[model samples]
Target chain A: MKPFSTMKLAVAFGTAALAALLTAPANAAIVLGGDNGWEVSYGGFINLFFTQSDFDSQVPACAGPTCSEDSTHMQEGLLPAFHTLTAKSPEIGGLKGTAQITFAPDSSGSKAQRLNKGGAMIDMREVFFNVSGDFGTISAGRTLALFQRQAILKDMTLFGVGALVGPDGGGTSLGRIGFGYVYPDFRTRFTYKTNDINGFNLEVGLFDPQETTGTAAEETDTPQFQTEMTYTTGFEGGSFNAWAGFLWQELEVQASTGGATGDIESFGWNVGVDVKMGGFNVVGSYYDGQALGTLLFPNVAQSYACDAFNCEEAENDGFYVQGTYTFNGKTKLGVSYGESNQDGTATGAPESDNSLWTVGVYHDINSWLKVVAEYDHQDSETLGNEADIFGVGGFILW
Target chain B: MFSKINIVRFLLALLVTASWSPLARADEDIWKSGLNLYVRLTEQDDAASGRPVPNQHPVNLDPAAIANSLIDIQVWDKHWFKKDEIEEVFSPEQARLLGQQLAIALRKASPGQDIVFAVSRTDTKFLGFRDLSYTAGRAFYSNDRLNIIIGDFMRPPDKFQERATSSAGVMEIKYYFRHGRRDDPSDFESAVMTGDGVEVYNEGGKRRLDWLVIDVNRASAARLAEEKAGEEANAPVSDEALRQEAARFAQERREMRLEMARMRKEVGSGQTGAESTAPIESRLKTLDELRQKKLISDEEYERKRQDILNDL
Candidate 1:
């Protein structure tokens, strides 16, 4: 109740501020402490969804081929809605400040929080502050990495399934971090854009280990550092976009069980190309990371295999090509086919190959609203065969 | 086998026969009218048949000097004609024979007035078979406009009923001069003093209007005035500089008056009708005779040719 009331107040304030901003002249002086100086923006979406899949059941070591479409259940529920209130400060000495507090209500009770269960939830997301200027931008808060900016920036609709899953297994992931991966630290990074030397742009980022925990002065047993460099090239034809990025991290952590004391070096590299030609847009990516040293194996056990010699390196490489041809800007038909292969070099374990295919139609009700219905099928040779899922959802943003 | 002398004589006779044919036709006479008009629809060399370049000025209007009146109608297996020979020189009767047939053929082949037709033609000093040909004829009514043709009827429509001539001259309505003189010291000084009391400069009698004489070749009352003017102007321009200028002008003007006094007199007098046509027609037959007869030469002929090409 308290949240709802605060949201209503925010909506009123934001509406008034927007009206003032729209009416003000570009060079007009704003009243510092009044509605003229303060801006609030409110946005939210509600979803009613039903999902029916065929292979929702769990099987143990089934020798025969199983249909992914079976063992599916149909459910209907009112998913929790997401809303945000953003406040921007009046320009002070050519420096402006922006702070946003977002609220995504969780309606999917405890069952929603459990593993491998279908329930509706809000998965409260993103609260951050940003300041930008001639000398690049410094965001002393949480944010999606620069690598992920293209996806969120280009996503037009407030409601619809995205091209990739969000970290919370909702929303769209546009060629960014995968679902279930979150950067839980306040990352401070500086980026220097090298001059466009021959159509190539180089950007490098360094994330400090202490920015997130508010324990900069405290000392610990092990220190970790993560650094990444990305190089991008623009095509002269204006249709194709490509980027290659490499990430390296050094972590000092105790062994999971005992007193193991060695520096662990992890590395991940990805190269991606996106092409938008007439009537079709296709994207493909290849990712490889240090397998045995950092990445967890695909076993049901909570403990990692102990033997470095016997353990297979964490090698998961997957590529997907999705094409969507817009009949009009508002209506599109999309088809995607992807296959991911993960092989562990350990004995007695088979190589795991996962394949996923999807076909969907998306309709934009308007700029801020859209509806997407998709049928997705996945086959995991390592995870007991297959899974089929069908979902329809939409969102709104203003 | 035939003797060498007889073979030589036979070959010479054939050469003489070819030479005689075009000169005989040239004696028939050619006349020019007034101002050559051209409205170019395409940048095509063979405007009638060549492909048109895209998105350009689809229409052009130009006024050109008429070069000849001979309309070369090719007859096969009769003579070994030079590649430059474009039109057949014919007497009025001979011309009427071919012209009428062509007119009828033209009317049947092209029904619209938009077909290409010549407005004027020209010829030069020595002529056998002219490397170039000319045909002029266009008609204008109260409701219609002027149509001038120079070459092949590359235009899509319009066909005319008559022939073309080079002596065609045009009347100037008004002339425009830029306010400033060309950026040269001599030209600037001369331009400063050319004006009368008024600010405007007058250029009424700068050039010899002798083209007017060639345009109307008929012995009308107007020809008497032109003859008198010609005699006074031709009063032996003795200054070397002026004489050189006059020669240049004469060389340019000669194509329009192909049968000027000398050539006309050679054919028009001192011989019977059949023999009279032989001089001009004989020279018309071969490129060698063109230089040998001094009608046009290795130097002047080449200069004239290059000039016409440069004009093109």
Candidate 2:
């Protein structure tokens, strides 16, 4: 259904209909359901932030079974500014829509650079409609993949660590405009919300990379998929929330002779808690997953866990501690420290561990506006390392 | 005589409430949102034409109020007796000045509340079992007699007070007059009152009259009042003040009559032990006490008291 168009029609006709019903005399015989209904509200927020990071060339890198130090391969700090716009529709028929567009400036800053920037100036961050009721909510269109669900809850911030992860790996932003569907995945979902069971709630969704417009080579163009499940509940004033999920990807690597490639699957699970006491909140979680076979870079001859279907795997595990305090009814200060260890069959990739620490402050300008500034730093102890980023962004919506 | 005691108790409640009752004038019961104030009239202690309630007796306040921090009851004030002096002796202008002074004190005691006496005439309370009174009397007392001896003199002549200690004097005042009766107490109290007449007086002044029509709903009252006016029963209700007053009276009368019918229907309902908000017997006893004490107009007492019980 064209939800947007349908919403427009409902809004157009709802005004006169409401007036007529309210003005009508009251009678027990007539059911006055929609007369008391209200129209939806609309608002949105956008945030743009500039980040500059300098990498030290002294970081050590070793290769082969022995230690062989590499020369200083470093460049000056790079400055990148990313801007995103998020818009939301007022809730109608228990459904609301959201869309986000991200833009980044190109170097050679002026008009000449824009001409040769190769359409890289803009990106679709998130665009989807969420339909929900007492039964359950569904989101169809391009949105966060399943792998991001658990992390999304843990990260708390929409534009944080969880959003960057592709669910299986620690942080991999994959596939623009992925198709996401949340079915009553019994394992990961609450099937009885409509029936009113209060103790537990669960949900599961799968994100597939199949384009909106079908392509002839379906197998070749079909994007990798991820599935996730989450459960949440509250007991005796404390809440318990948990989630787990997996991702599968296909990489048709360049063949040594004939072109041939295989797909790979990676799975992970996350468990976390939000313990609240007085005004202080403490969060803790443990996540472990494996990235096996040739998931990223393909090995053509390796029979690697080969069945008629081809797939590889890798393993990773991480945990984090985050806390936030709210006061003055407007601003909140938060800090989190996390570490993850990534290990795989690939060489020079020895149990690579990464640590992330972030401190941020968020000020709610008003009910519909908020300003956020956060400093995030990551230290990777492996080959493809030397990567650190700082992000400060803000969002608004109504 | 038994009924007279209840009346005295009822009036004493009124007297005590009048002289020292925390029922009103102190601006003590300040309420915040989300908190409900439920009133249950336990019993009446004393009833008389004029009684001096000196110091307010301290009682064990509701513990729930502390946690809720939102609900409370200003049951009794020690200065209630002294406070009533202003109402009894001061002229309108004087009363206004006194009201202003008390208002300041009230503001100091309970901020955010307009410091004004809780109007006694319009507000109703169950003085005892089957006894109800709408009379006004001085109800205040100091926290201490400054030298009064601790004795049984404090206890009110009621089931709950009988079992309570003399220190319960303040409690008796608080429970019987100031606060509503408690749901549970340490006694097998017979919530009954036997009395002769009821009294009615239009102490009606400038105050918000919360007219409760026992059994009449809003629609029915409007319909009845309209029909009486010889207007189309379904005519749109005018927003005029006079029409609103008529509609209000119609509702109140309907409620009174409906309450009476409901009592008749429940005559053999076999329900016992504080079924009504206030016992009908209590109202009867209070009237008897008032008549014996000559504290109220006999005709008014008889007429209004019966008006109350006839509903039962």
Candidate 3:
């Protein structure tokens, strides 16, 4: 419990710090190396927001004692602002390569973390490198997970508040994450991507696998494997880019009794699309598979129990769809909805059907300032409560 | 992590080699490679919308040096339109028509440039309603007019999703310069002050980026200028020197004007005795002709007229 709480606080503070930093005036870039060598620069942004939530009091019949959801507080936006250091090689034979490090910290308590006070915690989010040429670009690092990359990236609430995952704490909103699909946490891996093959291409990679509950990290000998095939076509008016991706990994769990000790397998797949036509943009994603936990993959629900010689697996699936339209280049209106659930197991209880719906508007006041307002409704059968959250905030990027 | 180490090692090694690249030359030519040390420094300034480099400032480069050491290397290109397919897009007829249209429009604003020949059109998805074409061709002032050979045909293959400039039908490209200097000394000074700098636009062709980039041409001549601003591309210039040059030019202009007045008076006085009486009258007539033809303003003609009378 302490570890979970600490991790949550870390994420909250890291995101808040990013938001606060965004509000700071643009500063001089940190440059390393010299005039004819490698050059590196550092930059990032910060976002802060305020929310007012009035959770519905209705509880399911089997609801437990913990059912509070209403809250009023300042919180970080859906995505944490991260500072990054990008280094590049001086040109040699017309080709160059780049390496980047994205470091972010979590805020202490206040969502605003005004003046960067409240003792924030640091989170090393990503480190990656790429060497590009006429052939293509190959990248290796502990960066964003490949599965459902475009869906979450293109979400209207990507930088806005939605789903109220942490209505009480300034943690973070699920933002259709738990409600529809699992979180694709950053993973250590390598990927190979092709150049635009007539506006279409493919990406494939292998990632470090996560160990299940009661199992050591070494228990899983094999790495997770994944691939994504994307098709993008440009029409007279706009363009459409769609992708299908799949991930598979094996996990080992030690027997609590004497049954679930053999190697277990987890596999999942996802499909998504992004369309930008005129001033309108639309995005949709759907995912399903076995042993894919509801909130985040390889989560507690994904753990299986064994009875001497028998083991039971968890089957899971979910999806989300969203649409947005830009008006006059300054204002954008958007809406999104999603739902996800896990099947009941023979040895454990079934996961609840979680659903979330969000509506928001964002306005770019200037190059540095963006203002947003959103309303979200969340329903959970397992948590046994429905919550509605209203939030408004501003984001600054420097 | 080892990958990162290898990248650092590679960068270090390349640094050793880059010191020899023409980018290090004292008089590097940006028209050849584009990436130069001076430009890199200016590109790093992100504090304001205004960049360090001034617009439409002529940067002088040694043609002999360029011919000897320049190597044309394209660091960036999506190759959306292949070389063979370019003609299909920027056809001769298209270039001519666009160039003629620009000639009609730019005659006053851009007095030296007559046409925009380097023709490129908007992509089907280029977020606008009209079919506007960009004049990526180079504009050179020649024979008292700006002459652009429209139809260079190898530049800016579409991609203007933001500023849609065409209305009704496709209007010719407008001529504009930084601060609207119009081929003046201040304009050249602006260009020289900042040197040549290029911004690394976040081009999205690379699959590994997971991001998007916005790019624009920073060169004064054309939108499809070299990718990076070359190192030491501009001659070492000081504000004091520029002031001196302006003063010298002013002095020269005054002497030339006075000399021209003397020549006109001599011509009016006639080479033979028969026309000597008609000199002043003829000179006045000539001054009025110059004014009526708009060759000189009222004040300039009056000044010349008084100078010719004084000569008598």
- Please count the clashing residue pairs in each candidate, in the order shown: 48, 80, 26
Please list the residue runs of candidate 2 whose C-alpha ends up more than 4 Å from where it truly belongs after superposition.
A1-41, A50-52, A58-121, A125-139, A156-196, A209-226, A235-238, A248-263, A292-312, A346-351, A381-398, B1-312
> How far does residue A292 in candidate 1 sit from its true spot (Å)?
9.6
In model 2, what lDDT does residue A306 have?
34
Q: Stretches of candidate 3 above 4 Å error?
A: A1-33, A56-59, A62-69, A93-95, A107-120, A257-259, A300-309, B1-312
Docking class of 1: incorrect
Scanning candidate 1 chain A in windows of ten residues, the lowest lDDT window is A174-183
Docking class of 3: incorrect
| lDDT score for residue A263 of model 2 | 39
Candidate 1 positional error at B163, Å: 80
Deviation of model 2 at A316, angstroms: 2.1
Residue A214 of model 1 has an lDDT of 32
Sorting all predicted structures by lDDT, with the top scorer first, yields: 3, 1, 2
- For model 1, residues A1-398, the per-residue Cα lDDT tens digits are 01335534654575456345423323434454566676655545544334455563235544455422342222222223445556666665554555555444542223234322234434434455544333333333333343323222222211223222211232222111221111112233333333222223344444333311233222222122222222232111125555554444433333322333333334444556666554466766555554312112111121122243332234445555666776644677877666555556443224556566767777766444557776666565544445556667654434
Expressed as tens digits, the lDDT of each residue in B182-285 for candidate 2 is 11111111111110111111123411111100111222233334357434323476556666666666556545544443343244245454555247657778
lDDT tens per residue, model 3, B1-312: 113234335434433433343433122112211111010011111112343223122322233222211111112211334422111223344434433433333332222222222233554423343333332332333322222222222222111111111110111122211111112111111000011221111224411111111111122232123211221223354665665555565456434543343343334335444333247668888889989999999899989988876754
The candidate that achieves the highest TM-score relative to the unseen native structure:
3
